[model samples]
Target: MTTITLVQGDITRQSADAIVNAANSSLLGGGGVDGAIHRRGGPAILEDCRRLRASHYGKGLPTGRAVATTAGNLDARWVIHTVGPRFTREEDRSELLASCYRESLRVADELGARTVAFPAVSAGIYGWPMDDAARIAVETVRATETSVEEVRFVLFDEPAYEAFARQVG
Candidate 1:
């Protein structure tokens, strides 16, 4: 059976089987969680991502798809980076954001990852509502067909933490 866990913490510093990094198309590393992951993961991750980024062009985003990398400083063994859609319109954002969870699970299954950690997609710079994002996350996770044993939502703040906790509970 699969388990969905709501944890108040940092995705960039998780100690699970795999952690999801919300990245841009560049995937080279930008600000926010992306910068933190890159800094901690060191240069090897960037080098691997550069090549992965080239071959995995349009594959970077749209929510559902994910790319894999070695976990540098993180406690996990692998990092599965996913790009979530940012929209002023929910037209595609909803489906895409939900897919982020689904696809991440699929990738984890492929990598034999039994546990996964994620940051709240699009909630920060993407401006997605915290409650809505948490709902989508829990729902999509509930729908996954992979053998992911544990799913952890790592929140960076108290508000986000409480929001997810309320939804999960």
Candidate 2:
């Protein structure tokens, strides 16, 4: 069984085997966690992303899908980039949101990552409610079967941490 952990800190600083980035489809970089990872992980990350763009992801990564790249300067061996769905009341897109966690874990398992640090996918700029995002993330990780030994949700704020804590509890 995988142990679920929560930390109220920057995901970029967490030293895990893999760090999950809540990236936009562009994969080049954007605000929030994506930009932070790109900035801290240095040019090598962008270089890998560029290569991915040139080859497999020419139209940008699709929502609910995930891809891996070098961790670069961060304290991890690989960075798994997962695009999250934008929340909207008109439609129930919770499955796509849950896929972010599931797919990241899939990529982690593929990379032989025992420990992975993840941010709150889509809860930031993408506008997914914190409680719902937390619930989906925790529930999905709990349900998924992977080789990862530890899955850490590295939240960026107290509210986000508390939200995940509630679900984790």
| The candidate that achieves the highest lDDT relative to the unseen native structure | 2
- Please list the C-alpha lDDT of all candidates, in the order they appear: 0.83, 0.96
For candidate 1, write residues 134-156 as lDDT tens digits. Answer: 88988888877889998889899
Q: What TM-score does candidate 2 get on C-alpha atoms? A: 0.99
Clash totals for all models, in order? 0, 0
Give Cα distance to truth, residue 165, candidate 1, Å: 1.2
**For candidate 2, which ten residues in a row score worst on lDDT?**
102-111
What TM-score would each prediction reach against the true structure? 0.92, 0.99
TM-score of model 1 (CA atoms): 0.92
Q: What does the lDDT come to for candidate 2?
A: 0.96
Candidate maximizing TM-score: 2
